[model samples]
Target chain A: MTNRWTDGPGPRLRDVSEDELLAQIFPLLPRGGPVVVAPGDDTALVRTAYGSVLATTDTMVRGRDWLDEWSSPADVGGKSVAQNVADIASMGGRATALLVTLVADPETPVAWVLDFAAGLGAAAAEIEVPIAGGDLSSAPAGTLMVSITALGDVDGDPVLRSGARGGDVVAVAGTLGRSAAGFVLLQQDRADDDEDLVREHVRPRPPYEQGPVARSAGATAMIDLSDGLVRDAGRVAAASGVRLELSTELLRADLDRLTGVLDDDAALGCVLTGGEEHSLLACFPPEVALPDGWRRIGQVGAGEGVTVDGRPRSGGGWDHFHP
Target chain B: MTNRWTDGPGPRLRDVSEDELLAQIFPLLPRGGPVVVAPGDDTALVRTAYGSVLATTDTMVRGRDWLDEWSSPADVGGKSVAQNVADIASMGGRATALLVTLVADPETPVAWVLDFAAGLGAAAAEIEVPIAGGDLSSAPAGTLMVSITALGDVDGDPVLRSGARGGDVVAVAGTLGRSAAGFVLLQQDRADDDEDLVREHVRPRPPYEQGPVARSAGATAMIDLSDGLVRDAGRVAAASGVRLELSTELLRADLDRLTGVLDDDAALGCVLTGGEEHSLLACFPPEVALPDGWRRIGQVGAGEGVTVDGRPRSGGGWDHFHP
Candidate 1:
């Protein structure tokens, strides 16, 4: 779906007007009730229901992660916030706030920076978290590096990566491989100026609230789909001391979604190895009823490696450096 | 005081390890209460007097802020933690925890990453805070970016940059221009290998607790000396709509501390324009007695801009992007 507010290309960097992106995303966020103050403030205020607060930060450098021509400043900003927020989500906690640090080259216009900020603000608002504070600097090359820290409140207990049991049901919420499909689309769009795939490449719609939902659903193991399903699932498998097996038949729908749009090999590859969809992946007891928006993909067993249709998969997911 | 840890010459990147550096700096950190879990854990956990949490983050990139030859990875890590913690302190809060994100080229040795982590761990420990979580990524160029997010707790009311009153007395905790002086020393050190100044350039000793102390002492406004004194102080002066003036005599001791050790003009310039010392610059009501470890440096009045001895000064501060 096209975003009406951010649809048209406007004036050049210096002349473009400012639109409040935070206002758009703020109302979309899932409230955990622990947030004392949400976005649109100097800093977000969150109450720790238990003993302490958990925080983590990450940065995505433009040239390293995406090309400027393919991703707009807003897309860059949104992904930056989404990825960092996913880190917090992986811990089975709701993100309360975020702080962004940006570094751009001199040629990057003020409008680009503002648009980036708007995207970040919108993302934070969508998550019901605030853009608490940030810092800005100039880089030597035509590079843009965005660093974000996501703060979350640990309610009664934090669901750690080491918590899954042997017999838990591994499941996922939101679509997989779409981002990977979108990424390929982006590359092709860059070459041919194909608008459809270009849009998907620029913005991967992540299931933001699914994390908390899965957590509340008694998930024993949790992760965010950042580095493809197989790779991230492997992390859970390795961390939880259990083998995870995905059913190819169960993933047919996802594969079908990309069938006509992507090449056969590329479509399969995107589902197996795509990154940055920000979907929630979790493992729960076999008896638990799966929540809406969640699809059962795999099951946990008494082994270590992740498997596809009871067999070992060859390719590992996306690696920022290696990719 | 030469650091025995880094004494060896000639391509020591592989030989010198982070464990060795961490062992040296670990004992220097403040030990005891409020620190539930420290640096060795996947994430640090700290208890807050108040149930709520406050967090902020910032990142510094190489070439944009410092040169690698002059400063070690550990120094970069320490500065990252120190600066973010200072922001918490500015809010009249105590840092409970921190999370760091580091991006470096793959060619950057694992030892360097560890040392950087060690420095970050040491800085957090010094403030009785811990490194709760972190992310490591690879950069395309020979650049190092360090981002730190600090979680703080509000004891009562948060001291804001916008709260200074017209009649407040401006004061400072800790030395000013030392980092800047160290920077000059580092430049000379690069040219002539001046070891003395170079050491100061690496690990800056910020007055970590001064923020809370100033707040309790009835500070109306406060900020950290991340930027040079003039520039940061000017923020308060501008925000509070009050002119701030420094007593040159009060800063004489700080000046004398670096005298004979620096070139005349360079020394003055460093003291006036240096950044990243992380000292506390705050304003309090006229009736409040200055806290111990703090010196009265100036007074707030009905005017604009920062002044030295009732006269305006120029070219004596650092701006992150402008510089």
Candidate 2:
């Protein structure tokens, strides 16, 4: 209590009321997206295309999700937006708008809030999705969290995760293992030498536009690689009741890109076990042609869980509590 | 950390992986609303009505927003849904769906999460809005939180707070002072004696249908009383650029209802300064016939701010970081 607001230390959220904080952040919000009625209301009105709209929500908690020393406020905002938007893309829809909620301690710096807003604004601008409306509240001491809810519009019918079957080709439309490599680089204190790899861990760039592209090209099943390629693909495999046969040869391409950044085993592990990549992993009918940015990495088969080069990868990644 | 999920103590989240946790909670979700694609995917596809939809989000942090001793897990879940849904109602829309996120310690009980889900499910069932999609992540030890994003549909144009103008009559369709009085009752251990007041604090039932009723009755402006009557009325006044002249004579009726529960001054203060009531406060042209359950309380004029009994009340209600 004898800190920030009292000028005893750093800047504090308690110095200004929640109303004042929202007003300050209002000017920084982007209005370029499909917002019919902007913020500062009980609820924001947004435009959706068809009768069906896709929705998803995710959260990032400090200490558990990120450390302030390693990540800028902008990085937190961008990562939150990237992960949520990728969920919409995985649904074969366009991310239209987002409603965000930030919970912080009273001692949290105003600069951090503003920087987070900047990242959120930049991400929204990059994807053309508006920050429609959100809530701000204080959390228990020593805790700061950001939660985002993303809304999306589908073209016709949504491509679901349960649609993959035998004889389908598995493909990916974005980079993989970069985030994991970045994590390892950060762990090894090589972030300065490997800026791009570190950036991947701090701020993910998902192939959002490729979602609808895959849908248009008849993607049978799709998912976002938020929980690693093997685990997330296992989700699709379980949901579709089809075995996912992943090829280590096909995955070598991802590892090749990580050659100098990490060792062979680590690169391969990162490609298969890294989470938060936000890459689009999908399955398409064998006859369907793969679109640009999408490369065949595996195939859908008649058996059980995921296998890399005919070997089971039960060595999953990122267990929330246990980790 | 020694609690749930351990063999010697109890059930802990670490006992099951995130996938197992989701599977257990999925059956507890209510799918009564317009859900096209269900959970267990990257995102959920929901059916919308028109080209436009309403969106809002809110968060509740444990020990800061509520006390575990006073509120059950179900109460937290129900209250979270109630407040967010009320935001959509204030915009003159019907809430259609919600996406929820929960962050808790890995040592937290499985029963707590399941009970929270049950409360969320019951609330969704009560309002008929599907629990479309959600995320669960681990938090730092001893910290637990729940955040909700609500989606709503308007018939056509929404009733916004900025639309109130001169010669408009101000009215409300729900009760006030009950929640704040309930808060006091809980603090004093008077909750058992005043069951209704405690229930009011634990579970607020906002008059949702009355929102469209006001809109259909040609209401010009509207706001939800989440920040108390005086503060929220100030918002309407500031947004509409009008003086909101609240009649103490009219508020006497609200205060009168609290006579048996609280003192005169406390009741009046509660009616004027209590937040989280979620009552619909609106303005309609003088000619519009007042709908049932709606009662006139004041008038709008070419002025600024809010006045109670012809005097300015500069005092406001709840500040997130301060109060």
Candidate 3:
């Protein structure tokens, strides 16, 4: 298998080799801001409107979270940041910075760690966030685990899970089921060395800026798609005390994007039940025009449970323990 | 050994089993003016005066950082908070809050997780800093890892590692090397199961408030004792371009505390070289009266390297890869 060291580029640790994937990713970060500290310290520090900061953390482990054959270190790092940053965005906030902690086995190459950092750095930069600081530790098992804490600033009211109204439109920004579809493809091509599918499984492309877009669009309630559509939708449904009815026809274009790559059932399954898309799902007033890159997938009604084309969908998505 | 579920006098995760750990840690948090969002839905929000927040994360893995046989979950949780929180304090700030992400093996007892959270809660409460938020996931290995990110508000000046001047008074707050001694005792009594020594090894009592104390005392340079005095002191010495000379006489009290519990050589080794004490070491102008809970332990000179009583001390402390 091609490791990150031989396949990517970036600054490698002095004692450890550098990963090849990092070379392609590091240039994507944003620079210059009230970001007094970014991408290298213990944590990134940024200027907030009211001088208040928001922070959250998420951890991913190999075997349980991702497989080596399906993902590179950079992909691992990118997804780590994406999930944590989305948490910040879901609160109607802008991500300002991040801090990451990594634990890997001794047998794991140092280059993998460097590549992971670069991937995390690149992803943060893409969203104008920087890696402020991090810590590295050694684990005994052959596992690679990363913990990222994202910090953000609240410029307006934090759109909480409890904010959605009964008569709101349920919408989404960005593609769905791509990562999950990629996971299925990667599993099929694990030994075939399919770079494209593997890359998708490893590194997710989250709609980083869409959170602000949804907020500006006057969206009432929102969450990121780390879990499948139905599960994540269930969260908003349960919290907002409204039934969410999704129109599968609205998602036809998204499904078409994955058609040639996945079978009909797989594509539909991915779109409905896949997770880790990092897409923003929100409820808005009927009067609010759907923002660019956002699709109207459903509507909020006075009921409970999520429906796909007016029927209940089954087997939502992957759960850490259940999976 | 009593597990968390069986021992702790606290609530359990019955209906909230699927909820995130941040959900639990949030409501228990005491609200304050500095707190912006108290960690219900996603991230915890805090106000910073420096227009920037200082953040850091560290992960402690089972077996690598601690042995399950000797340590209780509470001890592991406390150390995780102590070490990460100490990083922010070393930068001359008080830990305002924290976000912890825990990864554990599925077979791991549920009781352990609760105990660990309780330990974290107790430690955060002790410092008056709440357990603002967190993430939890299952791992494949028999490991229990914790990653904590600590946030602090910078008041006046950020006392960076690159700040010390020549000829400064080197001082320390809180006791030194007790945890190291405790570690040694535990190692010797691994089979005996000495609860005191094991507790010390697991839960280090950091002088949490001493960070701000040293900062207010006009410390030119500061760091916490996660690495041994000489090693961590070396970091300040190298960063500040000054030499550090530690007086053994000032450490007599510490030596006395460990004497009966530890063999002479082992005790002295732990004191001078062992790590994770979380004591504050600072350099200031010689004219300043040492603050309360602080003792004059050394002098900053013109040359480089750490000298104990006049001779070079041995290099000792935990190394990430080597450990």
Candidate lDDT values, in order: 0.66, 0.76, 0.69
- Label model 1 with its docking quality class: incorrect
* Candidate 3 global TM-score: 0.82
Best by lDDT: 2
Candidate 2's clash total is 6
**Per-residue accuracy of model 3 over B126-228 as CA lDDT, tens digit each:** 7766545566677775666888887766565556665677778888887777777777767676534445545556788777677778888888888788778
Candidate 3 structure quality by residue, lDDT tens digits, A171-263: 998788877887887767643444454455577777767877788889898888777889888878877788888988989987997777788
In the range A18-49, model 1's lDDT, one tens digit per residue, is 12222322232233333343222112334443
Report the Cα RMSD per candidate.
Answer: 14.9, 13.0, 13.9
DockQ for each of the predicted structures, in order? Answer: 0.10, 0.12, 0.12
Worst 10 residues of 3 chain A by lDDT: A13-22
Supply the DockQ value of model 2.
Answer: 0.12
What's the alpha carbon RMSD for model 2?
13.0
Model 1 residue A302 CA deviation (Å) reads 2.3
How far off is residue A302 in model 3, in Å?
0.9
